[model samples]
Target: MAATTIRTGSGPLTPALAQQIAGDTSHIVGFNILITDAHGTVIGSGDTSRVGSFHEASLEVIRTRLSATHSAAQARALEGVKPGVTLPILLNGQAVGTVGITGSPAQVTRFGLMVERQTEILLHQASLLRSTLQRERELEDLVRSILAFDPLVTGHSTLLDQANDQGVDLTASRVAVVVHTPGRTPVPSTTSEWLPRALVLLRESFQHRQTIAVSISANRYVVFAHPTPDGMDGILSQARHCVEQFRTHLGSDVEIGIGTEGAGPTQMRTAYEDAADALHLGRRITRRSVTTIDEVRMEQLLSGIGLRARQRYTAAVAEPLMAAGDWNTVRSTVIAWCESGFSLVGAARRLHIHRNTLIHRLERIEHLQGWTTRTAVAYLALYLACKTNEFDAAEPSDS
Candidate 1:
């Protein structure tokens, strides 16, 4: 889409983006406008007939990088000329094109300058978008390379050289974040219109920091994120905000899994795997929309058991009581108590109940579950079983 964008001030200014700028500026200002490339060929004009024609007034402005004005009398001096003001379209201090207004030079000078500034702003935005897309594609390739190859295997040197050429520091600290939509394994499709929209949201949302995100599949996005000097908490906070945005805008309950920060391509690949694992496990084992691998280390360790084994273990610890109507309440109380560091007062405060009431609920749970929750062994058993039940219920059922 180079023809649709100015390439971050580095490449030729093409007609598609120029036409867009012309159309948008004309709409805003209620004026007839024309855009000419540095070569003086009219690339865009409010009057379509003017396109592909020469604009004599813009040539001098393009060459001199300055505004040029012409009166009705001076218009006769040059072929295909008009009485108007033409100003150079400067992006990054280089004149890429010219924007002109057709009217009395004095009357149109203000409008011409206004449109010129607007065009520059639009051009800069297009350039930045082009850069962001390019970076995203490169990062996608880099991530795939890192994930697919080992350092000692064939093509390692090629991967290293590619990273170097892309100006990515392969050894710098990065955290992998996997964003996935609910209910399916990812099926990658490069042709999905959804891909660009998702990539734009991710790149723009994190533009303040160094984050490269790509649509790895139809519903899965991977981001290689770098934090500020402080730590990862800031980035993760931003990520949660993005999750909220996704829910509101994308019509999907998207979840994020964050991996611990690591350096080197190999470690970054591991971080990617960890992030994916966190998302997979978190969706099954918890109600959390955002999961960090560090926070789910125990769950990860426990995930190795077979589904049948998990089903039996969870049934043993959670059943009978689970058949009762107030099982959700009991489960919440158990979770709250555990979250409150096993303090009755803290748990009572969190549940907004009296301490005696919390004790009564705990006693009821112990009576029905056939195990006292006071002992370390029993407490661990009950909690782990509750989590296992969560995972088991979340799994896809067979007919």
Candidate 2:
């Protein structure tokens, strides 16, 4: 014989889900439960033998989309039904299925309604969760397109139209911020799992209507937010707040870099590059959690030089000191003197030494290098070389 089919407005209910709902309800209420699709075909039942059977009362409930109660006499008059209460399962204002409890009508009538309500709630929650996940994926894709920085891949005109449809104005002053969490051992299998949580924290921190955030890598997230009128300071403050929020709520140690504000979509790539450069320079120079491109402009400029050229410049400028036997002392003396604005007393105090001792060191440096901290050009060269050395030393080594 051909199998019977049940149809609901939302579509036919799956037998597996029906069976699970029936089993859980039976366990809680201690009653024999039967679940039938809209056509009254018994898809699931607490009594396994009753599965795949037809129930006349369930058919009546489905037809009327109402609850029905049957006594022993009424059940005997109907086919394939016992003394029980049958409740219609409705989804979107249409009967989708039926839940029946087989027992004395007086005892199980209330329990039947309870089971119907629980089943409806479970289905509603599942539907909502599915919708939420779908929306998140769509937003993530849009963000990836925006950050991709490749015109051929992201189709600039199409993206602009989509952003407009989504109520986002790409032609606005915005800063790009990158949050990086270093030292994560054995990176998680899926970084996207943590991204939603991070977005939540960012939304709370920014409190702005037009912010876009997405994870660009396993350890980094990119955010674009419209800047306040106060300019770079305002952007930096927000970046610091974001760093604190991630650390406080997510227990993550993060370094945040804020880019110079770009006026429109065309400048987003430049802003992102600036933020990335700021992050690299900040990590090299300071222990601060938040850094802005403006704070590292000099380093950013210096970084544009080729690596070999920078190395050559450093070697040529500081070659005398590099050749000294006691290079460490000579370098420290020059650095301290420059940092103290070429003040003998200040440099001596910073070195925690007597004036004469500091003078002796400076005199030795001059004798060994033929260059003195007395000249602005010599001091500037030494300072730049020292910064280059610091940058090289701070660069991470690969195992």
Candidate 3:
């Protein structure tokens, strides 16, 4: 019985693997098995005495990359022949070893072929798994190297070279996108699994666009993409799409922030910071799923002030209202009124209430704070205080 070999460039099957195959097949077919390397020296065998022996038929099978069967009489006529079959084991399109079975010609022929097929399948799976693991490690290392880069340093030639080696062009124009998954806890067990899935989804969505995405933390991911002529609009659209996909998969809301496009590796640090700041300010100012740097640039500026100064500003303008039981209501009324350009009708319309109701709310706010929204200074103070309160709320605790 002759069968064509499938050549795969995998390494020669080890004695341990061969012995495992023989042990497993022994229970099903009840045949004595011998496993030989490409050199035809027996490395594994059901019969212990046959190990280290040479088999001519196994050598022939390896040389021709085919299977050979021998009848009992034919086996007896040849020196060191077995009344069974010898089959070449092929992996990655190359013959790596041979398997021989000693039993009745008909029984061993069928069983030996089955064993050879099983061994090839197992070896192929093992090779594939190893390759996948290696690729994942390489990808992770590349991401780490990129994040570790300090653009402000004088000598980044080594980092640039390493990035080039990984097919990432650090000199190209790139914009950073930060994805924030709200309410996600940073538990290692869950985040480790979740990040890979998110990365896969991002890659699939932006693969043709030459995007690079990496996990920055348990609930944050950074994606770099080269923007087209459409500029921030195109970037915002891509970010919105990613957030929508994440929402569909995770069944929860996600917010995305996009930074301005910047050139070269050094600018990546600034771009990443911009994206993160946009994300934070966007969550505080708007309910949109995606936010771009342009949308929150003013908030970004305001946030740069010292935290203590901002807290004092909040105290000076909104201190009286802060002690009220309905502080949130008072704050919302002031924000809506300011956002409406001090127009009672516009504020009432925005709040989905009658104009009279809005006037009552404003009067209550004025009474509580001892200041009416009449003068330009009053309007300015209230606006600044509202912004400061938001900034304070978003600030991380010192503890």
Candidate 4:
């Protein structure tokens, strides 16, 4: 007769199927199904009343990591209960319990062999699915960590705010602080021990859970910290302290910039930008020190110049004038003009120079450089050139 396919029954070994399989064998096919907990406590079984039954053989299956086998004789008194192949039932990739068949060696072995073969296929498929699920979870965790960053830092606030707002339910009461590691050497290529150590210091000092989403670039690491009700000052102070503690390892002077505190998940990017702006200022102005975006009041004045333009302006004007020795005076003059709305009168008054003296200097500048300060455009260009020249003067020759 065709073998009965009891794929689904009262779970593996019901009395009916067991009797059928037992009857098919020439010898007695004695068997018992066992169940156990994570700690080897038998909780239940296919047998009706085995609810609290405990079996040493069941424990052996877990401890020894071996497949089940049938035999005419039991192994030993202390070997738990020995029987045919013991089929382990697993949940969550852990063996929670097992099923076993016992009887005459030949018939029991045949039955066990059949059951073990089919069970192996099922278990292998299950194992592959479990592994795939686990990998998916790990990938999700990494993505979540990256998305948690406030994207407003890179000059795309409106778009980032909308996208993140639609995608995630972000906490509204948190703030972001940007810690900038200057130069190429101080920062490592990846987020390894040395980099993570700096992060640890920041988290500890601020008393917040710190998460490194990912590296923004080779030289920039974005740190997200929840804002405390104590205020931005406390947050900034902690950042300052953290930087100071790890100053030596950081290579370049460590400058921490904090963004403005605000509400909504969309606000993170804005906050990040604020902090980054603070860091940028800190690096350029406060060399070997810390600076905050709040302290950089001329963002409005410097708004029109992009990074590349600013660099070129600095190299062209500031570098040369600085090299020529009157950089300090030129800087004072340009700053006065920028601060005074580019009015020659206001600039002169601020510098305590006579209008005629200012006029004469202007004339001399035009004559010496073949450039005129007659129009607003010319004045603006001169102003930018002068500022660049000033910065170049301050920089070392190698820089």
Q: For model 1, state the Cα shift of residue 21 in Å.
A: 3.5
Q: Roughly what TM-score does model 1 have, to 2 decimal places?
A: 0.60
**Model 3 CA deviation exceeding 4 Å by range:** 1-88, 91-106, 110-118, 152-157, 179-198, 215-221, 225-260, 276-307, 317-382, 394-399
Q: Candidate 2: worst 10 consecutive residues by lDDT? A: 185-194
Q: Evaluate model 1: give its lDDT.
A: 0.76
- In angstroms, give how far residue 321 of model 1 lies from its true place: 20
Name the best candidate (by TM-score): 2
Full ranking by lDDT: 2, 1, 3, 4
Error of 2 at 118 (Å): 2.3
- RMSD of every candidate to native, in Å, equals 8.7, 5.5, 7.3, 14.2
Poorest 10 consecutive residues by lDDT, candidate 4 = 1-10
Residue-level lDDT of model 4, residues 174-279, one tens digit each, is 5666766567534343543333455445556667433323345545555566665667777667777777766655444666776676444446656676767776
- Which stretches in model 2 have alpha-carbon errors above 4 Å? 1-20, 32-65, 68-106, 165-167, 182-197, 216-219, 263-265, 300-306, 325-382
- The sequence of per-residue lDDT tens digits that candidate 2 reaches over residues 1-399 is 234453323443668778888887788889999889877888888887777777878877888998999999999998788998999988778887789999999999878767899888866655565566665676667667666658766666787777787677877767888878776522323543433576677666666778777666667777887787777777777878878877776678788888867755557778888888888788876668988888888778877877788889878888887776776676677778987998999999999999999988877766666764457677778878867766666666851
CA displacement after TM-score superposition, residue 296 of candidate 2 (Å): 3.2
